[model samples]
Target: MSDGIPLIPVIPQALREAAHRGTLIPFVGAGASRLAGCPTWAQLADGALMACITANKFNHGQMEQIRHLSPRMKLSIARAIESEHALTIDYEKLINPFDGYQNNAVGHRVYRSLGKLSKTFVTTNYDAWLDTEILDPPLSVSTDSPVQDTVATPRVRRRIANVEDFTPANLNQENCVFHIHGSLVDPAGMVMTTRDYIRRYANDRGSDDPTRENRTLTFLEVLFQHKTVLFVGYGLEDLEILEYVIQKARQQFPSERPQARHFMLQGYFAHEYELMRSLTQYYAQCDIELIPFRRDQRDWGQLTEVLEAFAEAMPARAPLELQVQMEMESYLEP
Candidate 1:
């Protein structure tokens, strides 16, 4: 089945088996949203900083200088804007233009391709695009807000506020969506600044700290350890999550090393052999298999075609109860 796509040289058999068995967990990143007209991280930061400069009648030269900086470096620009305006820019306000866009062709295709094979979707993006595509009536759980499960009829869609809301029973009940980062509805929870990342990931904090809780990181560790994580829309730039997975793997199997295989779909051109080879070796050390999609500059729909091909090759869906049981065991594993 994979032979149909000449562009993609190889698709791992393990990834196919995981998807067919409904054990594949999709870890969505910002690239997915960008396909739906949302700006990239760099663009989002630059746009907000530019707005701040314009509104305050600041020098255009500064805006241009900051615009050229990389996305991660732009945090400094955001800080500068805050210092000059004496006010923090609301990320939600900047993201307002992308709000209310419930449907996107690419998003719909992704959901359709995965079908009932996946019960849960995790994304770093703040957009509600996944809600539009996968969740009926668009339910979501945000790390920022709180949710209480009471003795009432379950709605078609729901949002979880934090890790406390996700019980083993709750996760196994039905399909769910998790916004590990802050969502659009709650801008304060969004991790945009350097300080936000530091606090969220506990960069300087001790693991035994009595006062701090890094629920998101803890959740990720468990997820990666158990699930056959299929990374979509991730550039593999964030080492924090990968590092946590590596740490847990080392701790669990110290003597006899076990391969913790994960998969990532990445876009690359023919000329970038060195780039591709370097990424392959890097992820290999982390026990990740990198699948490359040959992107033609003229063919915008190439990515969609690759995803569709993968969907076609996947085996028939498994029963819902069986799917839940398999996932549940991962959480219970010692």
Candidate 2:
């Protein structure tokens, strides 16, 4: 342990090694934002059903079973409502409710831990939780406030959402957050509905395509091929994105999951022995190592400690990892 911080045993050594080697990246999911008061995908989907009921639009055919529909299917209904009624799904207000949200201490702690872990982050979530919590301004920039984190560090710019933004020429400049599904900035771009997911998949050139031109696909493909990604803030139900990637990778590389160096931080209960075993077997099949933390009731309180330990265990790196190392030993001067 560096200094006196204890490394969580569940955090695999290879993940730490990848961190030191500058290959590990955190793939944030909705569960992380839920810590900060954002709605879960199920809750968000429920909003759609509630909205339909409030609008007196519920209970036609499958709409009769709207309450029972899965989140994805519920979102498909939302899309239909938006199309038919010209009603807007205020995702921003739903995501970042204008309550005492800024004072979300636990959420901020998690986001800050993420900042220390890596400069390049990938998240499927569309909220500005990370943008509000993580900052890396230039050292030259001075803040009037006494807060140290708001100044000179790994500056997190606005999330990169466009296909044009993922290029190494663009990403190599500074800290980057890749929001694979679009953020709240562009509702049209965000993948929420079933149709949206289909459209996104259509745009992606599969892993086998050497000549694929889509920047997002290339970025994901390259990261999976080369990096050890530790996926945090995901639940058993919300791992469709991770599963999608593995399936795609198998089309090209069938011997193992394409993301062979992947890991996920998961929560389970004391009584979920059988469930845990099944999940472990499933994740192993997908080539992901589980970093399980036991939780109680509705609180994943230990997740914060686990994240903190991960940040502390992984050695820090020079800025702009794709460039030369900041602490490099001397090579022979040419």
Cα RMSD for candidates in order: 8.9, 6.9
On the 0 to 100 scale, the lDDT of residue 169 in model 1 is 51
Each candidate's number of clashing pairs is 3, 2
lDDT by residue for model 2 (83-154), tens:
788777777777777542456666667777887777577889988766543444335344665534333233
Estimate TM-scores for all models: 0.75, 0.78
**Inter-residue clash pairs, candidate 1:** 140-159, 141-160, 145-161
**Candidate 2's C-alpha lDDT?**
0.68
What shift in Å separates residue 296 of candidate 2 from its native position after superposition?
Answer: 3.5
Tens digit of per-residue lDDT, candidate 1, span 56-87: 74567777766667676686567656766676
